[model samples]
Target: MERAQPLPSYLVHRYQGWKATGYADNQSWYRRLAELGQHPRAMVISCCDSRVHVTSIFGADQGEFFIHRNIANLVPPFAPDGDYHGTSAAIEYAVTALKVAHLIVLGHSSCGGVKGFHERCLGRAPELAEKTSFVGRWIDLLKPGYERLGGNDADIDSATLEKEAVKVSLENLLTFPFVQEAVDQDKLTLHGVWNDIGEGGLEYYDAKSKAFRPV
Candidate 1:
């Protein structure tokens, strides 16, 4: 194990500013949250991209959304074979332990991971084709979506594939028996969302319409 280095000067200054402002203003709120423990109503699985701010998007307060971020905002089909699975572990905790009522799979436009996967499947980006590549392997979970959408050549463009990544994650969430049971019991609801980072617009999946509509 290695001791992490001290924070950079800029980050230290930013932390100080937050402590002096946001933290100071909400000191009691923070203390109460620490005492109560987080019981967020929804669990949001979002991309690791910097531009997608879940709190800012929904104007959420602390303890309002339990957020788990990963590459491409993906959720692989449940596999409980004793393998190390960070995303699945988080999902299990959020559903079974936290009992979150809503689970959201949020994808975004201009996602580098999705673009890389799309390019890789098209016989480009040879680096991503390697099994040892972490990004490649993680985004591979979204392949079922591409296959269902017609395999990278189905007249659909790259952006639609990004949205389909959201759809894939939603479908995969159901593969977990706990998640499925919760949904069946009406204790949990699943949602798929695609955000246009540049446009600052959100599109939500509609099961009945089988399409994404802007909100």
Candidate 2:
């Protein structure tokens, strides 16, 4: 076997230029970040997909959002056990240590993870049985949403499933002790967001409208 090649010429040149210009400021940003620590006012739970970048989509600056990214941005109910619990640990730190006031679960269009979940449930992709070993276990948190669909799984569109998964994650967030406590004390708020990749639009869950509206 052979190792992969280095980056292309254009990318290398562009990266070098960005490194030169982006870092030429009043001070080195990395040092400032280390000194200031992350004091983000809000925590955003988003997918690990490269296309759904939280900072780029929200136009957020450094230290603006304490972010946690995982497959499908799913937050499982609080459970203390042998589970790796990467997302839960980040949530604990954000809520208990950072004490962020707002927690946003951002879902985007055409999420591959959610599509994988759908396929696993529908038995279309058996190879997913091995690949989804961990992801399938995590996505079980959305079992209620699957039940809520209450129709032919084939007829359930991927977009609809993706949106429902966000709602499921929001519901699961309440299961966390720290998050529940924060919400009960009126110290934390939960938001569900849908980001449209094609149109560059953001739709937030509107309680008054009972639908997702432009944000």
Clashes of each: 0, 0
Can you write out model 2's per-residue Cα lDDT over 161-203, one digit (the tens) per residue?
7788888889889999889999999999999999989889898
Candidate 1 segments exceeding 4 Å error:
1-3
Clash pairs, candidate 2, are none
Candidate models: Cα lDDT each: 0.94, 0.85
Using all chains and alpha carbons, the TM-scores for the candidates as numbered come to 0.97, 0.87
| lDDT, candidate 1, 1-215, per-residue tens | 49888889999999999999999999999999999999999999999999999999999999999999999999999999999999999999999999999999999999999999998998899999998999999999988888888886676687899999999899989999999999999999999999998999999999999999998
Distance (Å) between predicted and true CA of 117, model 1?
Answer: 0.5
**Candidate 2 RMSD to the correct structure:** 2.9
| Per-residue lDDT value at 119 in model 1 | 89
Name the TM-score of candidate 2. 0.87
Number of the top-ranking candidate, with TM-score as the measure = 1
